[model samples]
Target: MSLLTTKEIMEIIPHRQPMLLIDTIEELEPGKRGVGKKCVSYNEPYFAGHFPGEPVMPGVLTIEALAQVGAVVILSCPQFKGKTAYFAAINNARFKQKILPGDVVMLEVEMIKQKGPIGIGKATATVDGKVAVSAELTFAIG
Candidate 1:
């Protein structure tokens, strides 16, 4: 069972369908950490033109998914309730492998630093234990 479903996540964050990349949040620590999951599908809209014959999930989307999970961590706080977590910056992002359809992306993000409304999180997305992408994400809670 999921710790938080898509409906529950929507209550915390503003993301909706076509943009809500995470299907389930398997684990979470209100304001410190979160582990989410995204099951990539062949029917994803991006697969149409991301490549004609070869469909690959966009790297930027992968980063966005990570950020969304991070948002859940921050936005779940009572102080941050009804707030939106905006991407302040992305640092040291590395795409290690191509994420394809039928792959399940395991998303993990840990809040490492925070000051006032700004914070940073170390995020990683993996598939079958292999790192697909990782980055240091900065966010501002509004």
Candidate 2:
């Protein structure tokens, strides 16, 4: 079972359908780390134009999914309750492989540093034991 479902995640983060890419959080530690999953679907709207014949999950969306998980880690903390974590920067982003429909992407983010509302996290997206994307994300809570 999931540690947090999409419904519960909705309460923690201010994201709605289409924009809310994280499907379930398997593990979470407030202000520390989070592991989540997103199952890509062929019917996704982006697929309609991303490529008609060969649809692929956009790299930016994958990164957004990672950030959403990171938001969960940040917003779940009692001290940060009701706050929104805005994407301040994305560094060292690398997309290794294409994510296709029907693939379940494993999203993980670990808080590396934090001071007040500014923080950074090491994030990664993987599929079937292989790394698909990795990045360092910076956020400012508001």
Candidate 3:
């Protein structure tokens, strides 16, 4: 069972359809960490042009999905409620494998440092227990 459904997640963050990448949050620790899930589909708009013959989820979008999970982590904090978490920076991002349709991505983000409105999270996205992407994501809550 999911800790936060898509509807519940929408209540905490401002992301909407198409742009809202995470389908559910499996684990949460308010401002400290979160584990989210995204069910990749062939019908996704990006697949139309990302690659016609063989579609693959873009690395940037995967990063965005992970960041959205991070957003949930920070935005769920009582002090930061009703605020948006913007990407201040993304560092040391590494993409290890292709994320294809019909795969379910497990996104995880752990807030490692924070000061005032700025924070950084260690993020990773995996499929079938294999790492697909990993990065250090910096966010600014506003």
The regions of model 1 sitting more than 4 angstroms off are none
Over 4 Å off in model 3, which ranges?
none
Q: Compose the digit string of candidate 2's lDDT tens values, residues 1-142.
A: 9999999999999999879999999999889999999999998989999989999999999999999999999988898999999999999999999999999999999999999999899999999989999999998999
What is candidate 3's lDDT per residue for 14-95, written digit by digit as tens? 9998899999999999889999999999999999999999999999999999999999999999999999999999999999
True-vs-predicted CA distance for residue 136, candidate 2, Å: 0.3
Among all windows of 10 consecutive residues in model 3, the one with the lowest summed lDDT is 9-18
* TM-score, model 2 to reference: 0.99
Clashing pairs in model 2?
none
lDDT of each: 0.97, 0.96, 0.97
Model 2 poorest ten-residue lDDT run? 74-83
Candidate 1 C-alpha lDDT tens digits along 49-139? 9987999999999999999999999998889899999999999999999999999999999999999899999999999999999999999
Candidate 1, poorest ten consecutive residues by summed lDDT: 74-83
Model 1 clash tally, residue pairs: 0
Q: What shift in Å separates residue 106 of candidate 3 from its native position after superposition?
A: 0.1
What value does the lDDT take at residue 28 in candidate 1? 95
Local error of candidate 2 at 5, Å?
A: 0.5
Q: Which portions of model 2 miss their true places by more than 4 Å?
A: none
Candidate 1 structure lDDT: 0.97
